[model samples]
Target: MIEVQCQCHGRLNELLPPSRRHRPFTHRLKQVMSLQQLLIPLRVPHPEVDLALINGDSVPLSRNIRNGDRIHLYPDTGDLDDPSLVLLRARPLQRPRFILDVHLGRLARRLRLLGLDTWYRNHMDDRPIIRLARLQGRTILTRDRGLLQQPEVTHGYYMRATSPDRQLHEFLARFEPWPWLNPFSRCSRCNGLIERLPESEVRRRVPPRLYLEFRDFFRCSCCDQIYWQGSHYERLRRYIDRLGV
Candidate 1:
């Protein structure tokens, strides 16, 4: 049997419940294993995006772990300024795009409402989700720990919050998507680009009263869904104000 000392720093521990948040814990293994293997039993999701130090030296997830080794893990820029530190994941996306699992539909729509590129379908299974994420270089945002635990999901996160509002708050804090925020720019239903449409084009599509009341109109390029500034716009504006972006 092999025994190793492991510790998680920064907000990494916050991802777990209080009962499992203990740091500097001892992990015992029946045989020598890779660093990824060690993280499996500890419920560390998407370890590729994290930094791992072994006995004061940085190493890859595939690095073989031995008995009595001391390991420390950090998430999202924690202790990353060290000159000798090594990064396990690839470069960050120039513009963040996300593919959410089945449970994050509300969050996905909210993200799209902010003009973020978000792909979501209620009927999508895990296999296709991972496959699409891999192909498009999109990050996977999921509430399922098991989905994030998949080795193929290199860029991913496990949302700890249950409610959609809290989940958005948590995501904003973690990813800091403020730089890319563009409100009312995408189709909330189909995740397609939205463009301003001439009033004459949408005159027949909308109610006569609405057409007379609202001068500005928009339509989704892919889905052709019409949008206008109305009562819902005020509520949406208020909600965006609450986000503090």
Candidate 2:
């Protein structure tokens, strides 16, 4: 038999039986079971867990549970003190760049607006998303549990929030991007770098009224798309400002 308990973060508490949440309850263990086996079925993947302790000792996801063992799980809180458990973390990244799933176009746009490198396509399929993510050292962002559970995915995030606003807040809270955020620096449409373009250079390219009314202009490095500080720009700036350190 095994006793399972989970931390408050990751919404894992919701998935557990109410009486079992934040507390342990014995369950029959027919055979040895790994941490992945227990949590994956509960919809919490390896990417979301900070640490796992078995029998009051830090253990990895591959650690097998024996009869009469106790288990505890924590979210990515960075408080783990055991040196051995540190290796249990899939791997740390040099930096966080992303490849988002088809349904996350709005979230992709928001991430790119903060100058975070995010690859997104409305028509892209999972195979290609996985391929590009692996080849480019990018993290896969999806709402697909099966995809996140795949063995090949070294880094991924499963979006729990349905609304884009809440999703962004959740993501920002996790990544703590206040230091990295660079607003109005990427194409909201194409995820391309935006740089200042002289007014005279685009004088004839823009509407005459816009050319006269707007002095600040930027162009996308990848798509040659143009941008000016319009209402959308102001709104996004306000959104970024709302995220304080």
Candidate 3:
């Protein structure tokens, strides 16, 4: 049998038995076990935890636990009001671009509509999302707390709000990406810049009535999707106004 101690922060102590709060708690285990197994009985949601340290050394959840091992677990820094843990080193980009996870497609579209250079993929796997964020120096916007816990993810924001409109407002209030807003300058379907195209160039693609009605048109260089001012534009404009943009 071996003794283990838990040093938890803030309300995390509530997760422990009443007698263990502000005190060293001991547990006995037979032979050896993995950190994952040890934590299973604690009932702490694994996704909310970001890092675990064993005797001052970082270790993975799958690491084996031995006799007399002391484990310290930490929740995501974003959950804590600690400033020291909040500001990590900025990535290479002067302005942070974003890659939205599968659950945040609506927020991604709203961000792109504001021309914030957001990348969105409904089917992006965790591995590729992390890789893209690292390679492109992009910040990850995800609702899954576990994904933000990855070590490779240096810049990430865990979305707090579930509603798409509230999520956009939350991000804006948190990051203040106002300087990056370009407004209707990007493809809502794709994160590509729209380029001006003469009416004559896309005349065949539009209805004759539309050609006579609207003089301005923009085309996406990446997906070749066309954009023109119409009812959708007015709806989006109203949304932007409601967003206080």
Candidate 4:
């Protein structure tokens, strides 16, 4: 048998054996076991953790277990500037597009409303979500720490805020989408370009009073949805103005 010691984070003690809490905990595992297999009995989700150290040396999750291995694990980044111990899973994008997880549906709508290219599906399974993020070169925005930990996920972020407004502000501050914001140019419902539609053509699409009063209109090229500058336009304009860019 091989003996290993784990250094766990506060509040994560419950996931470990009682004797291991608040101190170095020891466990016995058979020889020739991988680090991933050794972590299974700990009950903590190992995949979400970004770095793991064994005897003060960085090792991959696939590293083999041996006698007297001292292991340490750390959560994902709370700040961007930190020492690198593990290989980063995701690559940064040149012009980032987002694929939001099931939980952040409201934030997805707000992103689309702000003219950002965001893809959202409320029922996407975890495997496909990770696959899509990698295949399409899109960033994964999720509240699920487990999903972010998947080795297949190359670029991902955990949403720190719960409220939709705060979440939007946090994302905007982190990614600075100001230069990319193209207000009213994207379809808020489908993420497609909004095409200019003459009032004469879309007259029946709008209220008869609006057709007579206003001459400017736009239509979604993908969904055939019609739009006009009504009170909602001014309201949205004011909201964007408050975003400070």
Candidate 5:
């Protein structure tokens, strides 16, 4: 018999059934079982686990379980200085880029608003998404558990929050952005670079009275969309500031 208990933190608690969260349970192992085999069957994926202790000693996922072993699992952020305790995840991209699966179109745009290079297409098939993820070294953000389970998926996260706003918090916590991010540097609609255009050049793109009120203008490099510092700009600035960059 193997007794297991899980700590309440990270996505692990969210992944469990409401009835069983933070509860200890026992499973009988007729034969020896590795930690991976045990947890996967319980629907707790590897990325969801930070530390696995068997009989109060930390052990790797590959360590096999003998009968009567006690397990304590934690969603700990392993010590960055200690390699052994680190959670297994793909090395974050040297240059951060993300490929959002079909599920996260809104999040895709928000990431771009933060000047992060985020690629998204609505209802895109998984094969190409996976292919691009591997080919481009892009991190995959999705709500699909099965998508993260793909054998070739080297970098992926199972988004737990449903709303777009909360999802951004999860992303910041996950990747801890490496690149210097300047908000409003990218097109929110098309993922293009945004640059200032001469007021003369943007004349036709803007309404006369509105343009008179807001003299500054910017355009997207790819989509040629125009942007100005409007009331919405303040809201976006406040949103980004709330996210801490």
Candidate 6:
């Protein structure tokens, strides 16, 4: 049997039961286990995105817990830059791109509306989401804490809110993606860049009344979808304004 002192910090502590927050809890283990496994019993969600320290030395989750060990877990704030601090995940993304899970389609579209590079599909499974995140250097966003626990997902977040708007607020607060927000700059439907198209070029694509009333038009480079400052623009503008962009 082994006895260890475990403590959680920052948002990670929020995942623990109320009794465990802001306090070091004694964890008794009957058998040896990795740091990742230790989190299971502690109810720490999204362990892969968290940093672990043993005796004040940064360590990976794969490190085995020893008897009398003192373990500290922290959220990956991306600001810990001392040479003594070892990063548990890849370097922080300066300009983050995103790949959301199937459950986050609404959030994905909302992110696209803000001109963020958000890749999402209703049919995407967990494997492909992780694969795409790895191959394209996109951050994974999802409500599934289980998916964030996967070892391959180095840059991922578990969304805590249930509603899309609340989730967006939660994400903005956590990731602070405000600097990259360029509203109405991407195709929310296809995750494509929206480019200004000559009115003459898109004249036939839109309705006659729309072409006559709207002077400016945009088109998605990937999906060829046409956009314009139509009647819907006012409502969408109001919506975007509420997003605090």
Work out the TM-score per prediction: 0.93, 0.84, 0.68, 0.70, 0.76, 0.89
Error of 1 at 199 (Å): 3.3
Pairs of residues clashing in candidate 3? none
Cα RMSD (angstroms) for every candidate in the order listed: 1.8, 2.9, 6.2, 5.0, 3.7, 2.2
Off by over 4 Å in 4: 1-61, 64-86
Largest lDDT belongs to which candidate? 1
* Candidate 3 lDDT score at position 64: 82
Worst-scoring 10-residue span by lDDT in model 3: 83-92
Better of 3 and 4 by TM-score: 4
Q: Give lDDT tens digits, candidate 3, residues 10-114.
A: 444545677867565777776577775676566443434556767777677778887767777765344556433322233336776999999999999999999
Query: In candidate 6, what are the lDDT values of residues 68-179, reduced to their tens digit?
Result: 9999888864676677665666777767899999899999988998899999999988899999988988999887777877767778877778899899898889888888
Q: Quote model 6's TM-score.
A: 0.89
Please give, for residues 100-173, the per-residue lDDT of candidate 1 as tens digits: 99999999999999989999999999999999998998999998878888888788888889999999998898
Rank order (by TM-score, best first)? 1, 6, 2, 5, 4, 3
- Indicate which candidate wins on TM-score: 1
Residue-pair clash count for candidate 6 = 0
Candidate 6's C-alpha runs over 4 A off are: 43-50, 76-81
List the pairs of residues colliding in candidate 1: none
Compared to the true structure, candidate 1 yields what TM-score?
0.93
Give the better candidate number (4 or 5) by lDDT: 5
Q: After superposing candidate 5 on the true structure, give the runs of residues whose Cα lies further than 4 Å from its correct spot.
A: 1-11, 27-39, 50-77, 80-87, 198-200, 204-211, 242-244
The lDDT for every candidate, in the order shown, is 0.86, 0.76, 0.76, 0.77, 0.77, 0.83
Task: Point out where model 3 deviates above 4 Å.
Answer: 1-93
Task: In angstroms, give how far residue 10 of model 2 lies from its true place.
Answer: 6.6
